[model samples]
Target chain A: MNRYPEIADRLMGLDEAVSRFVKDGCQLAIGGFTITRNPMAVAYEIVRQRVKDIHLVCHSNGQALDVLVGAGCVRRLEIAYGGNGRYAPTCVRFKKAVQRSEIEFEDYSNYQMSLRFLAGALSIPFIPTKSGLGSDLMNYEGFPPDIRREKKVASKKYAKMQNPFSEQRDEVVLLPALTPDVTILHAQFVGDDGTVRMKGLTFADIEQAKAADAVIVTCEDIVPRSFIRTDPDQNSLPPFFVDAIVKVPYGAHPTACYGFYDYDPKHLNLYRKMAEDDALFREYLDEWVYGVSSWEDYLTKVGMEMILKIKANPVIGYAPGLDRK
Target chain B: MIQYSDNEMMALAAGRFIKDGDIVFAGTGVSILAATAAKRIFAPKAVIFFETGGIDPSLDEIPMAVADLRAMAGTSLNSGLIEAFSIVGHRKLHTVAFLGAAQIDRYGNLNTTCIGDYFKPRTRFSGSGGACDVATFASGVITFMQHEKRRFVEKLDYLTSVGWYKGGNSRKELGLRRGGALAVVTNLGVLRFHEETKEMYLAEYFPGVTIGKIVESTGFPIDTSMAVEADAPTPGELQILREEVDPQRLICQAVLAAPQK
Candidate 1:
């Protein structure tokens, strides 16, 4: 008898997972920060499946966010920051898309976005914070009034009211909670029983996963039950929270995964170059996304030598002295 | 005479502002360099953390981004974004954030969002990641900039992060209890806000940079009465910053120029 019968049933291929759960006009929350642990394999598969009109919600995303937006999979975006560190100060394709007014977009600070996810996770209607009190984030409503009536979109950008607890004129900004249709993340390990473990900084991944209706996790390694259970503290999420689990090694390639590898600077640099022009970006999609048969095939295109160079040291949790430039 | 880059000077100048027991919140680019320099050279006891929730990391290598794996390496504890923000505004802690922006106003309000209109920006930058949060919560903020007239604008295209708001007690009147812009560190000099008016005034011009050059470069009216010539970067400070803080010269590498007599 399979110890993890429920997880066994949920285990599916990346293509199957994307087709079944991700649909047109679904709200999405992607895990990871600027240069680490982005769910790239699923992002690529979404592109391959030509998933469209995704309303992406993010805090400070990088590789996967850029790829989805670049490949024209995203229709609406609510983001705090879109950057890839030193590689690209502002994500090239994201910058172009916003500058060209290709997608409906709104902005929030990282804390505000994180709080929104937290509020969603807690099943709250709205969350109050002092973060965007005096900035344009409070003034400008990026989404049009008509779009506000949509299912996932908030009714208003933000609402301000005086603090009820304080007799003095203490005011705060109230942000609407975000409950995305799905949240996807890449992790270092997922047990056969479906327990997930992510090393390094979790960013807002936990809150995002809890906030979503469905959660998809793609991981580098799927370990045995005994190993994952030995240290409960190390595990990130409970098995029941994860709706689908796909084991794809280097699932976050070109983005760092703590003890797994460093971000592939060479690839990121190439992407930066290719994403600069419209014609070249299409070629990048053809050669990289559409051209590849599978994740393994994609890795083969990335090659063995670069893999070895980017591999992280277990003790330090990153490839020290990697040629980041 | 020792020749130093502008980055080297800026890092040292900003690092000096940090003291022991302060919590330093660092952004990427020169801010990282300055934060590291502060810990290594100025304040060994100061704890360096990232917005991604890496508390007191060893920082064996310079992180290219706030979420770089290097930031998580050898950390005392590795948490996530919510926890990190908790520490930033913890009331008890004295958090000093270092940030860079595309444009800044006379009151130190920042624009990291977009140029032109918000709807169709001519130049779009990475929108305020955590700058707004830190600027609101941290005990103070030290901003980095390139001293150019266009960058030091009278009015920002968009204010992504609130500094002094409209100056004076405006930030306080806007409902922020504590934090405000502490100083502005640039390629040419250091600027501080007035105690009463809250307007930016030239506090220190670098050894070679003239007061007139600073005045010419600023887009808005600035007070020069309080301006004084800043001390040159010492050999010891330069050695530590170049050798230990950033051996890769990732952010510290800039065109070397001789200090004017």
Candidate 2:
């Protein structure tokens, strides 16, 4: 029989092993709508793991994608939902890459994301879809549009007409399926058996897990199976759905954890200033993620005192985990 | 005295009602200029925010476009653009500014999201981002857009964010809390919710702007409040706008970088 704490281990990664677990061609999904995305800090583990050329799917949380994009590990992207600016704009890189024809892009909608997950869960061929079609999205598949036009003739109290600037009927929109290479998510808890826990169901994420060849998770806490069974409904990823889970606290730091606390300010200030100069942006990445030998080293560089100050401050509305305000 | 071009007149009319502190947002294109003017001339202290890009309104240049800035809240003032999202979404500031749609209806609701029905939208523009948050979070919201019949519609297919539907004080009928369109600033004139019925009413007009043109453009009846003024641009405003603010017109994103002060 396995020992009490050792039983919690599905597998263990030492300094070098941790990096190896995050192999290439793995489709990753991270939780977060806007405010509370799981920490890409665990993703830093992927980078430290030397994971390469992987597909990243960010639902709601834009920061996780930014982390991977900044890391230069993303080869192709399948983004269903990204916040306006929660993370750096990969779309720019994706756009530039597309213009150069350097990479592949597959933009998706929330509903379609859910259908894709349903496909993976059901183990189907592809999620036949409907959403985001007809609009420029259809005219320009795989490329983000200046605006998406539909097939309606009437205007509303909020929206007026399209480019015609007149009330004319457009066409129908169909949202296609989204399947990531690997799905990476952040959770409040992952039990001994590997059940993912988050704020909600996140249909898109579920689909990514089902569709992806494999799934990886970055968790805040690793507990006994008994603990997770206490609230099964809150369990997002069952052991059957998830393969690996990394335990890292304050992983979402700059990006923001959900409700427990908000994003770390100095870190955000670091990234905001990066746009002024890419060199500076890359340098910050090196210092923050790449430079550190491990998550522990990253913390040391950021300084334990600073982390305490951040923790000491009242958790802001944006994230740590809960208050959806 | 500052020269009063039709558009400048349009700006001044919108400038009214902007208090010392406001969460003024500047969208894309010329709409940004009107919003900047409002912040520079009227709401200086208002916490300036945006569609997620850099936070402060003090960018030397507007970058290539809105998307170029990403939608993060960080700004040139603090940290870089990318970093600011973490700061703002985390609740660092209290106010934010947003770019409004071309057409607004009787209610102050905006429609950046789509043109038709949700199922089969005619135009699926960038759906409401933090705009919903901005309209709801900011102390007050001021939307800017060009003035034209096409821009001012009878109704928006989607209820992106309730601007001043049923008017500000009277929106209890629709059911909302904290946010309602405060003012709609456009190239031709200004529109606000009626003090009561939540109807679109003329609060002010640009110099040389006629009541007929404004009414003709609007889908709903344009009611008149007080005898509105032209509120021409002040020499100080033009000087700052042309020189200190946007010498290269980068910040203004002006197509024709009008003569510098």
Candidate 3:
């Protein structure tokens, strides 16, 4: 009856998958850009389990990054940007953490971060780019000297070298590669065969997956092997790369998943209001994250009206005129 | 006589800089408005793209952020970050990027990272997302700012993106092949770089805005000898920006008090 018997062992619950791969102080990469397709369900589960001291590497993450940092689960971060689209220009928790010096942080441009992941996937030690040539990203190293010597941290923020092939004066910034201990992503569909398919804008998820030692994927639906195999072009990653697969509908809530739903403006607006103050943020975490028994319970709190309101029109890929204000 | 908001006039003024066949890299807020205005009104053939890898999206609805789902819908191609950067620095393409910053200097260098020490900041903004990359790789950059004494500083607290890079051949000496600050659009007017020295100079002051106000608002001395009064927004231009571009008034709602000459 099972179309793909090979991947039957990989299918597991959210708790087991996260507990198995994500551990204390491990280097992690989360896939998404700003406000789209964040692995929120898994991020919440990590918070519920109280996974501590995570070293997060990302390019331009939004809700997931904010939630994890806000929950006090992250200790060190290598990121490009920390802001939601329109909700919070600079993520409230992230800004507070940086200003308070609670966590060690470093900054890179999106291209530099992407190229680092690409280098890791290519099995190269480092990569070169023209970005951040004269910028302070090259001048200031946010990580302390001790942390630089620690495992999974780059020895230097950046290095400058003359182009070996060029006869004239030419320079490029060399960035160390990033091979995360585990990479987490949320997708529109994952086949029973373990092939992952993302609907719109992969946004370096493929690169992050390839550069990680392990990959955990949460998806909206689990399709049959026969259905997913009919169109291989749509597949984002092959079966061998994904170590864990969990089927969780509305997994990327508060973040847009193309063809499924738009970002929850009402919820994000509420989060923005609560995240401003320390006491209010804790209460928000208690009600939204800790108080909820399960993802289903969380959905109940989100309510059916809000769900229907944010539902995307399949053809358009977002809720048209959904009063995003 | 037509009355236009600051955002409407700013968008139209920046839109005029775009031309046919340009690859426009857009950030959020007024930058998105200007990109849409450029395509619909000024340069119909110009393409608008996002750093998140949505190339030439239909943009039927205005996107609040570069990663908004609307940016991916009806796009010519849906790729990822790497592919998008390839197009930005592509030798063949003429890419023009639009950005925003918290602080800027006489050389047009921008600071979007932090306001204080590197170890601990008084204020930490969303770090250089892709502004640094586009400034390094694109053919030119147009920045949007609020004209204020604090914002237009003589020296940046932190240089997150290189503009002219200490002026003249400094940017080129730093190994970047092309791209530098082209113009700065603000609530009061437009500022352009000196042809040779690369220092920012007042190029245009909006209608009802005085050059004296601009000089006073700037943190450093600025050259206003070449400045002229910018044309007021036309009735047709305002209509397109209001009715068609952003009917919801998501970004164009703020109506500043009329400027006194």
Cα lDDT tens digits for candidate 3, A282-321: 9999999999998899999999999999999999999999
- Give DockQ for candidates 1 onward, in order: 0.58, 0.05, 0.57
lDDT score of model 2?
Answer: 0.50
Candidate 1 regions off by >4 Å? A1-6, B254-261
Backbone clash pairs for candidate 1 read none
Please say which candidate is ahead in lDDT: 2 or 3: 3
- The regions of model 3 sitting more than 4 angstroms off are A1-4, B254-261
How accurate locally is residue A46 in candidate 2, as Cα lDDT from 0 to 100?
A: 66
Worst 10 residues of 2 chain B by lDDT: B252-261
C-alpha lDDT values of all predictions = 0.91, 0.50, 0.91
Candidate 1 lDDT, tens digit per residue, A231-255? Answer: 9999999999998899899899889
**The 10-residue segment with the lowest total lDDT in model 1 chain B:** B252-261
What's candidate 1's DockQ score? 0.58
For model 1 the local lDDT of residue B176 reads 95
TM-score of each: 0.98, 0.52, 0.98
Which tens-of-lDDT digit does each residue in B119-216 have in candidate 1? Answer: 99999898989989998999999999888898899889899999999998999999998899999999999999999898999999999899999999
Worst 10 residues of 3 chain B by lDDT: B252-261
